[model samples]
Every structure is written in C-alpha cells, then in structure tokens.
Target: MFPQSPSIASASNVDILIVDDEPTNLRVLSTIVRSYGYQVRQAISGIVALRAVQIQPPDLILLDIMMPEMDGYRVCEQLKFNSETKDIPIIFLSSLVSGMDKAKAFQLGGADYITKPFQVEEVLVRIDYQLTLRTLQIQLQQKNNRLREQNERLKQEIEIRQQTEVELRRSEAQLQGRTQQLQQALDELKLAQTQLAQSEKMSSLGQIAAGIAHEINNPIGFIYGNLDYASEYMEALINIINLYNKYYPQPHPEIAKRIQVSELDFVLKDFPKVLKSMLVGAERIRDIVLSMRYFSGYDQAYAQQEDIHIGLDSTLIILQSRIKEQTNRVAIEVKKEYGEIPPVNCYSGRLNQVFMNLLSNAIDAIEEKLEVVEEPFHPIIKICTQLSNSSKQFQDKNTQWVEIRIADNGIGIAPQIQRSIFDPFFTTKPVGKGTGLGLFISYSIIVEQHNGQLQCNSEVGKGTEILIRLPIEVPQSLDVSTTRKVKIAPSSLSLESDIGEM
Candidate 1:
C-alpha cells in the first residue's frame, strides 16, 4: 500500500543535511543518512544548503564540493564564519580522486572528505558519532550547571551552621564565667565569717579578763589590810617572847612549860584572822579560773537554740563581778517571762555573745545619761516572751513562732546611725571599748543562719526596744530547684528571737 520506509530513517531522530548537485547523489546520501535514523534535508546546491541550514541547523552536514552555483568550499567557509552556524560540522562529499583534491577539501574548511563512491556504512557511522558528541556536550553542560548550584548552597548552609555553633560557644563561656565568680564570692564570704567568729571570741575573753581583774582586786586589798594588822600583832608578840626568853634563861621544866603555853595562847589569837584572809583570797582566784574555764569550754559558734533564760543565767554569772560594784550606781530591776517552751535550737555561744553586747551597751548608755553624776538610774532589764503565729518570718502557715522582746529604758539609738549599726566594724564606743563585730555577728547568726529576720526600733533620748520573733518549725517541704545553696553549720542552740539590736 505504501513505499517501504528506509532503514536509517527509522533508527533515530537526529536532523542531518546532505548537500549535492546531482539528483542521484542527493537521493543516495539522503537514503544513507536516513538508514541511521537521521532526519535528512537534501539541498541540490550550496546556496540551497545554506538556506536549509539557516532554517533548521543539522547536527552534521554532508556537503558536495562541486556545485553549479555555490560550491561546498564557499558553503563551508560561510557556515564556519557565522557564529550561529559555526559548530555544524560539514564533511565534503566530492568525486575528485587526487591527493591535491583531498588537500584542497581540507584547506576549504571541510571537516572530512567523502568521495562520490562513499560506502553507506562509513557515512552512517561518521554521522552517528558526530551526533553522539553533540548530545554529550549538552549533557555535560547541564551537569556542570547543577554542580555549581549545589556547591553554592552547600557553602551557604555551612556558613549558617558555623555561626550558630560560635554563638552557642560564647553563651556557654559567659555562663561558666558567672558560675566561677559566684563561687569565688561565696568562698570569700565564708572566710570572713570565720574571722569574725574568732574576733568575737577574743572580745568575750577580754570582758571576762576585765571582770576578773576587778573581782580579785577587792580580795587582794582586804588581804593586804589584814596583813598590816597581823604585822602589828607579830611585833607585839615578838617583844613578849623576847622578854620572856631573856628573863627565864635558866633551864627549868615548869618555866619552859609555862612559856610554851603562853606562846600557844598568843599564836592562837592572831593565826585565825590571817588564815581567813588568805582563804578568802584563794576563793576569789578559784572562782575566776572556774568562770574562764566554763566560758571558754564552748566550741566556736554555730546555730543551736538553748533556753533563752538559761543563757541569761550563765551570762549573769559571768557579769557578776562587773555589775556587783555598780549595784547602787543604778536601781536595777530584773523580770523574767520564761515560757514552758523547750530549749530552742540556736548557736549557744553566739547567743551569749549577743546578750553580752546588748547588756553592756545598755549599761554604758544608762551610765552616760545618769542624772546623778555618781549614781545610775534604776536600770531594769526586762525579758518577756510571747508565743505568736508570726508567719511573716516563715512561709508555712503551720510554723509555730515565739517572740522575745528585750526592752531597755536607756539612751536609744540615733535615727541617722541606726541603719549603719548593723554594718561590720561600725561602732560608737572608744576604739578599744568595742570591736564592732558583736551586732554584725549577731545579725549573721539570727537572720542568715536561722532564716529569721532582725530589726531594730529605737529613738534618740528615749529608751530602746528590741523584739525578736522566730518560727519554731521549718516548712514540711522546700523546693530544691536551685543548685546554689546556703550551707549552714550545725549548732546546739536556736535563735527564736535572734534579732539584731542597735
């Protein structure tokens, strides 16, 4: 029904052009090009071929060197010179059979020479190879473009990741630096607290020393006066013994007996008085030693609660020698409002140290403002206790609190200096009279250690009032959400009213 299709025309869709002057040659070349699956364009002359190439460029050109109007040499040169069609390879198809002919074909810019008696297989193979090369070039170009895009994207992602890592490192370094700073500050604070405890201990010893000196002085004075009288009695007794020895030089048994007996009488009369004076002096020394041993026995202060009133009793024993003489110097009144509460857990030594500071300060204030130049006001030291549910100091509603109020009718703290009094090394006493650590240490123990609050309320020219409120129990559960902790040293005494007073 239809003309049989040629083998080359069914093979591939590559567009190939054949240029030749003879109709037979054109038909034959077209057939050969089509057998390899190429789409063939036939131009009878170089002019027609150029027009065909301009319309649709072939992958390769099979050009005939000889033509009536435009030869293959001119066509090849024109096609090679034009940028748009330069890469279309043109192989010359010529009938010239000479070395000169081949040379001329090459010189005319023909890529290859194929004589008129060309084998169809050879022509097909050449066309297929050239077309394959073009396809490879297209693929290579596309691959290169893709690679460039990927490289750029990779570079951008790498830069972003690097920046993020650097920022993270910086943040981590800052956090580490802050942690180190906090640790150093905590270390310094602990060292400072240790030094303060040592200083307070020394101050307490100093007060004890002063008290002892005053106490022993009185006994020494009495002993010295009694010795003077004994000296006089010894002089009289010496005269009597001398007279008796001179008068009774004869060795008589009865006389010796009478002399020994009279001497015994004289000795009995004076010995008892001297012995009593010496015994009193010895007792004073013994008491001083015992008091020092008792006060110094405690280990360095930590937190624990002792009976507040019990501490008062021990402090009274320590201050007896100092206050005994000043008894008439002031009308002193003592009142105790002791509660049935158990011994509070607090730093026993630190608490005693606080009492010593407050009591001494009160004495000094009262003494300073005493209207009777030589006498002091009726100094009354009142200690009162109230069981309050002071939840302010504790966050738990179940916490039981006890309030201890120590009020003094003495010169009060000036408003301007009241705030600064709690500061370490702040003192109004003469240089050696105070070390300025008492209230500061007290503040640390009460507020910092016991989780209590210390407050001072006073007015100038009026009396000072100090109240201490403390929770009896700790909360059932506390959140340990923070890594930082306040390390507390254990102690036997607790500060219920561990308050700082100015």
Candidate 2:
C-alpha cells in the first residue's frame, strides 16, 4: 500500500515519462498522471524515451516492451546503468502480462510492470508505490554515506592517539637519559667534595705536625746533649774508680760509700725518659696520616644496596630544605609505620628522585593549604611501608605484587578530572609551578617499566591515597590487559637482589 501523498506545491513537482508504440496508451497515462498533478512527456518508441531522459530526466517512467528499433527492456537497462538517470523509477506498461515477462522486466531493472489495458486505479497505485520505494532507497544511501564519513574520522582519531603514545615514549627516553647524565655528574661532584674535605682536614694536621716538630725538636736536641754529657761523666767516674781500685783494693768499701752512688743512678733513669718522649712524638705523626687516608676513601661509586628504609631516609634528607615555617617557614613532619618488606630491585638514587618529588608536592600542598596562616599549622607528612597482602587478595595461582601506598592530607582532585591525572601534561598546579609530567613519569615507571599498577582515590577537599602495586619478580614480558590486577606473591618477593649492591 502506498501513502496518500499530500499535494505538492506545483504540478511540475513529479514529472512522468510515458513511452509506447501506440498513441492511445500515451494519451491514457498522460491523463491519469495530470489528474495527480504531475507533468508528462510522451515517447513513440523506447529510443525516443532514452533520448528524452538524456535531454530532460523525469521522476517516473512508464515503459512499453513491444516496440520497434528498441524495446522497453533495453531502454530500462541502459537508463538504470547510467549514473544520472538510474534514480528515475521505470515501470513497464504492456498487454503482454505473462509471469515470465513480468519477472524479466523486473530483472532488467524495471521498478514495476502492469498490463497495457490496465485499470486507472491499479496504474496509479503501482506508480505511487514505485516512487515511494525510490525515495526510501535514496534515504538509505544517504545514511550509509554519513556512516562511512564518521568511521573515517574515528580512524583518524585513533591514529592520532597511537602517534601520541609514540611521542611520549620518545620523551620518556630522553628524560631518562638526562637523569642518568645528571646522576653521573652528581657522583663526580660528591667525589670532589670528599677529596676537598679531606684536604682541608689534612691541612690542619700539617699545621699540627709543623707545631709538634718545632716544640719537640728543641727538647729532643737538649735531651741528646744531656745524654752526651752523662756519658763523659760516666767515663771520668770509671777512670777514677779504676785508679782507686788499683791503689786500694783492700779499702774499696770505704771509697764506694764516699762516692754518691744513688745520685748517679737517678741521672741514668731521667735521661732514658727524655729519649722515650721523643719516640712517642714521632709515632703521633703516623697516626694522623692513617686518619687522613680513611677520610679520603669515602664511598664514591653508587655501590649502595637497595635499602628500602634508607631510600625513605634519603627522601627525607632531600625534602629537609623545602619543609620550613611561615614566610618560607614551612616544615613537613613525617610519620612512619614500617613493616617486614623484602628488599626491592631498584636504583636507590632514582627511587630517591621519585620520593623527593612526592615529598615536595605534599609539602607544597600543605603550605598552600595554610595560605592565610592565622596560626602556624604544623604541616605533617606520613611515610609508611608494610608487607602487602596483594597475593592473598588477588591469587592468580602463580604470582603476587607488593603494594606501597602513599597518602596525603591535602586539597584533593575533582572526580570529573580524576581519570585525566595520569594523562601527560595534565596537572592541577598553577602554570610554571608544575611540569605535569612528575606523576605521569612516576606512573610510567611503576606501570610500564616495572609491570605494576598505580591508582589514586580522592575526593575534593579530602586527601588522596596513591597506591602502587609492583610484581615481586617481573615476568619475562608483560601484557597490560592480562596482568593489570595480578598480585605479587610473598614467595616471589623473596628474590630480592639489591640492584645497587656490589
């Protein structure tokens, strides 16, 4: 059934083309179409109908199959194949009404077929129905074109995201390279500083050595002169004793009593004490040289082991200058509740960098929180670590992860912007105050480099809880989609090798 179309604005809106060998059929269709407010063009043969369409296309075509020179089937085929005239609905109007004929007409691309001696009502119904179908086909084609355009645009958008990921990886590689270079320079600087401090300390020892040499050399010189004088006195006394023994061998007891034997013994003992003091002064110089050597050989290489505890301590050390009070008097206090955690495989220096960034951000948030400081609010920070139960929580029948959570009591993020926090260059901080890459870099290290998970939970005006879950033993390769929520087993964490250890 066709819709009873409301009358168009003008009779010329729907044009009808009628083609037949009989002049009577043309007259009949023209009259019927004119009543429906349609303009009509008459053709004596199929050749004339095709020529007429090329000259002036019509909305509908009434075709005759039995004609001279060319038939309706040939005309319909030629018209349907042409891009310009293909949309014009063609209907076969003929006396040859066999089933095979109707099927052949349609197969040749005819919109409809009716007997030449047709009812006016039946002809009108078939014409309206064919025209309506043509309209629907046009709409469907238009819809398909629109969908194709949308898919192309979506494809372009995906390509842009993939390109962005590639650029991000390049940027991360550059940053890592620069960090390694800077670390090397810092190590060199520390070495120079250690050498400088040792030099300063040894310079003082040089002065002390000069002072000891000046003060003790005089005493040592006089002590040696006194020993020489005592040797002369001993030689003179032996000569006298020999002479007396020769003269009075029997009276020796009387002569020995007369001589001062006790006084002579005192001189011998005091001379040895002076020489002993000189030897002790020489030994003091050797002790000072040993102390200087020990100071010069301070640890210069990054040979320190992964000290989870020391990592945190170094973080505190780096953040010390930033934590002060009002008027740049901001001080951050830290609280810790450490638990039994296996040593993680990590570069302590790099981990220290991460910890320092986090600690500074926390302190900054607190300082800003007390902007209009009525009274000094103590900016408190808490650093805690514990053995994770991630393995117990998400048992995958294989491995487990270690969970390290960092919490801060500061103005939190809005829910709408929560998911975007990990996005590159996305930050809530004032412009120039943050690079927005800190968290992104940290996220990549944990999630990309270590095959870990980084998640945040926060509400506006409330604090944030940042949880980092790292696998105990990193697998040979990682699939983000597959191992996103996996746990690191306690047994696996036991493969703790201090990356920095010698």
All models: lDDT? Answer: 0.65, 0.64
lDDT of 2 by residue, 107-199 (tens): 988888888678888988888777667667767777888988898999999989989988999899999999998997776565445434543
| TM-score, prediction 2 | 0.46
Backbone clashes counted, model 2: 13
Model 1: runs farther than 4 Å from truth? 1-194, 197-294, 300-305, 371-376, 391-396, 473-502
Instruction: Assess every candidate by TM-score.
Output: 0.40, 0.46
Candidate 1 C-alpha lDDT tens digits along 1-502:
1222232233455677888889998897787667655678889888989999999887779988888878888899899889889877678888887999889778766767777687776776666555555566656767888998898899889988889889988988988999999988876676476555665565567567556766765766676566667667777776876677678677489877876877855665766666666767666665555445444434444444456666665666676655554644635455567776656666555556666666676666655556534443456566676676545534566666666666566666777787677666778888988866666666665555455555566666555655555556423232312123223222112334321232
* Best by the TM-score measure: 2
490, model 2: CA deviation in Å? 26
Clashes of 1: 23
